[model samples]
Target chain A: MKSFLSLLIAFVAINTELFAAEAGMPQLDPTYWASQAFWLILVFTILYISISKFYLPKIKDNLDNRENKIKEDLENANKFKEESEAKLKEYDLILENAKKEVLKIHFESKSTLDKDIQSKKESMEKEIEKEILKAQKEISELKKNSISSIQIISGSIVSNIIENISGDKLNESSIKATVEDVSKKNMNKFL
Target chain B: MQQFTVQRIGPEINIVGVDLSFTNASLFMVISAAVIMLFLFLGSKEKKVIPNKLQLIAEMSYTFVAKMISDTAGSKARPYFPFIFSLFMFVLFCNMVGMLPYSFTVTSHIIVTLIMALFIFIAVTIIGFIKHGFKYLSIFVPSGVPAVLLPLITIIEIISYLSRPVSLSVRLFANMMAGHTMLKVFGGFVVSLGILGGWLPLSFSVALTGLEILVAFLQAYVFAILTCIYLNDALNLHH
Candidate 1:
C-alpha cells in the first residue's frame, strides 16, 4: 500500500510537471479527483438506495403479481375445463340412462300388449268352441227327431196305400217297426 | 481538452485541505442519477401486467443486468445486485449522455473509472480474504505446476491479479476517450473541408457516432460483466 501510494504520487507529480505548460489533459489533473470521488460516492449512494429501496422492489412485485395472476387464471381455467368435462360426462351418462329407460319401457309395453292379445285370442277361441259344441248337440237332436218323424210318415203312407189297394189296415206299432228296419238297412246308401 | 474540463459549479468547498467543490462532472453525475431514477420511477409507477414501452425498457435493463450477474457470478452475487446495477447504469448513462452535443463523459475520465475499479478490487479482495482467509492467496498460485516453474507462474499470476483494476479502468476510459476524440477529429475535418469535401468526413463522423453509441453500451456491459467475474473469483476462489 505504501509503494502504491508513492507510485501514485510520483505519477501525479510527473503528469503535473509534464503538462504544466499545456494545461494537460483535464482527466489527468489531480485537483478534480477529490470532488469527483465525493460526488460519485454521493450520487452512486443515492442511486443505489433509490433503486434497491424503491424501483427494484416495485418492479419485482409487479412481476410477481403478474406471475401469480397468470398462474391463478390458468388454474381456474383448468378447473373450469375439468368441471365442464365432468358435466359433459355426467350428461352423457344421463342421456344413456334415459335411452335405456325408454327402451325398457318400450319393451315392457310391447310385451304387455302381446300378452293381452294372446289371452284375448285364447278366450275367443274357447267361446267359439263351446258355441260350436252346443250347435252340434242341437243339430244331432233335430236329426234324430226328423228321422223318427220320417219313419212315422212313411209307415202311415204305407198303411194308407195297402188299405186302398187291398182293403186291409196294418197296426201302428208293427208299421213303425217295419219302417225302422227298412231305414236301418238303407241309411248308409241313402245318406 | 475543453470536453474533459472539470469546471467548478458552485463556490470552492475545502474541508481540511481537501477540495470537495462540486463541478460540471458532479452535475452530470447527478443528471445521470436523476435520469435513471426518473426512468425507474416512471417504469414502476403504473406497475401494470402489460408493460408500456418505458416500462419494458426499464424491465429489460433490469433483467439484462440480472442475467449478466447470474451468468457470470452465479446466484451468490445476488446480494450485490444493486451495486452492480447502479454501476452499470451510471456508466452507461454517462457514456450515452456524453454522446449528446456538449455533454461531459464521466467514464472517459481515468480518475472516475479508476476509483470505481479500485473500490471493486479492494472490496473483492477483502471479500475473498473474509470468505477464504489465507487461502485467498492461493489464487496467485497455479495447481499442478512443475516445482521449478511454480515461482515464475505465481509471480505472473500475482502481477496479473494486481493489474486487474488498472486494466479494467483503462479499458473503459480509453475506449470512451478515444472514440469521442475520433468523433471530434472527424467533425473538425467535416467543418474544415467545406461542403464539397466535407461529405466524406461527415459521413465517417455519422458512422463513428453510431459506433460510439454501440461502444458506449458495450463498455458499460464490459464494466459490469468484469465486475461480476471479479466477484465470482472472490466468492468462489479458483486457482
Candidate 2:
C-alpha cells in the first residue's frame, strides 16, 4: 500500500514539473490532480467490477477443478485399499475354517475306526463261547450213554467169568437180558 | 454563411458514419496477441531440457507458474499451473507491448481487466460449489462469532466476497491506465520539445518506463497469485 502511494506521488511530481516546463508559460491547472484522481478512481472501479464478475471466477474455477480431481482420485484409492484389505481378511478366515474342518474330519474318522474294531472283537468272543458250550453238551450226552452201558456190561461180564471158571451156575433170564442189552449197546457203538 | 474550416489529418478509417472504431485499443490487443504467439512458438520446439530461444521463455514461464502455484496454493494446487502460467504470459506480453511508442495498453483499459477478473471470480465460485455442495455457504459464516452477530458479520463477509472481482479489476486497470496516460503526456512533451529541453522529459520518461515495467510484472503476479488464493478458498473453503 505504501509503495503504491509512493509511486502515485512520484508520478505526480515528475509529471507536474514536465508539464510545467513544456508549457513554457504558467503553472499546470490546480484542478489537474483532482481530475486525474477522479478518472483513476473511475477506471479502477470499472475494472475491479468486471474482473470480479467475469475473468477471476473462470480462472478460479479452473484451479479448483484440478484440485477436486486430485482429491477424488485419492478417495478412490483409499476405497480400493479398504476393499482389498477386507478381501484379504475374508481369505484368511476361509483358510482357517478350512483347516479346522479338516482336523474335525480326521478325528471323527479315527473314533469310528476304534468303535468298529471293539464291536468286531466282542462278536468273535461270543462265537467262540457258543462253540465251546456246544462241544461240552455233546461230551456230556456221550458220557450219559457210556455210563448206562457200563452198568449192564459189568454185571454180565462178571457172571460169565465166574461160570466159565467154576462151571457151576447156569445163566439167569435177567442176566441174559442185561448181557444182550450190553452187547447190543456195544455193537451199536462199534457200528 | 462563412463555411471555411480546415480539417487536418483525417482518420485512417471511417465506416457508416459510426467511425468503425477499431481504435488504438484493438490495434494493441492484436499486436500483443501476435507478439505473444510469435515469441512462444519461436521460443520452444518439442521442449528441451536444455532450452533453445523460444524454449527458454516457455520453460521460464512454466517454472514461474509452477513455483507460484506450489508456493501460494501448495502442491495441491499444482494442476492450475498451465492456466495461471498462460495468464502471466499474456498479461506480461500485453504490458511490454504497451510500452512501445504509439502502442495502446489493452490491459490498461477497464474492459479487458474486468473480463479477466470476472472470469476468475466465476471460476472460483464454481469450484467452491462443486467441491463443497451447499456446505460452501458455510464459508460466508465466520467460525468464531456470537449468534447475535451472525447476521451482521455474514452480510459483511458476503459483500467482501462479492467485491473480489471489482477490487482485482480496479487494481490492474488503475495502475496500467494511469501509468500509460502519464507516459503519453510526457512522451508528447519529448516530441514537441524538438530535441532541445527534451532531455528533462526524456530522462523522466525513461525512469517512468523502467518503473512501469516493474509495475507490469507486479500487477500480473498479483492477479495470478490472487487467483491461486481464490482456488485455495474453493478447495478448502475454510470458515
Top DockQ hit: 1
Q: Go through the candidates in order and give each one's C-alpha lDDT.
A: 0.89, 0.68
Instruction: Name the lDDT value of residue A171 in candidate 2.
Output: 67
lDDT of 1 by residue, B130-162 (tens): 989999999988889999999999999999999
lDDT of 2 by residue, A20-50 (tens): 6655311122312222233333434443443
**Against the true two-chain complex, what DockQ does each candidate achieve?**
0.31, 0.01
Off by over 4 Å in 2: A1-191, B1-24, B146-148, B189-197
Q: What TM-score do all the candidates reach, one by one?
A: 0.77, 0.50
- CAPRI category for model 1: acceptable
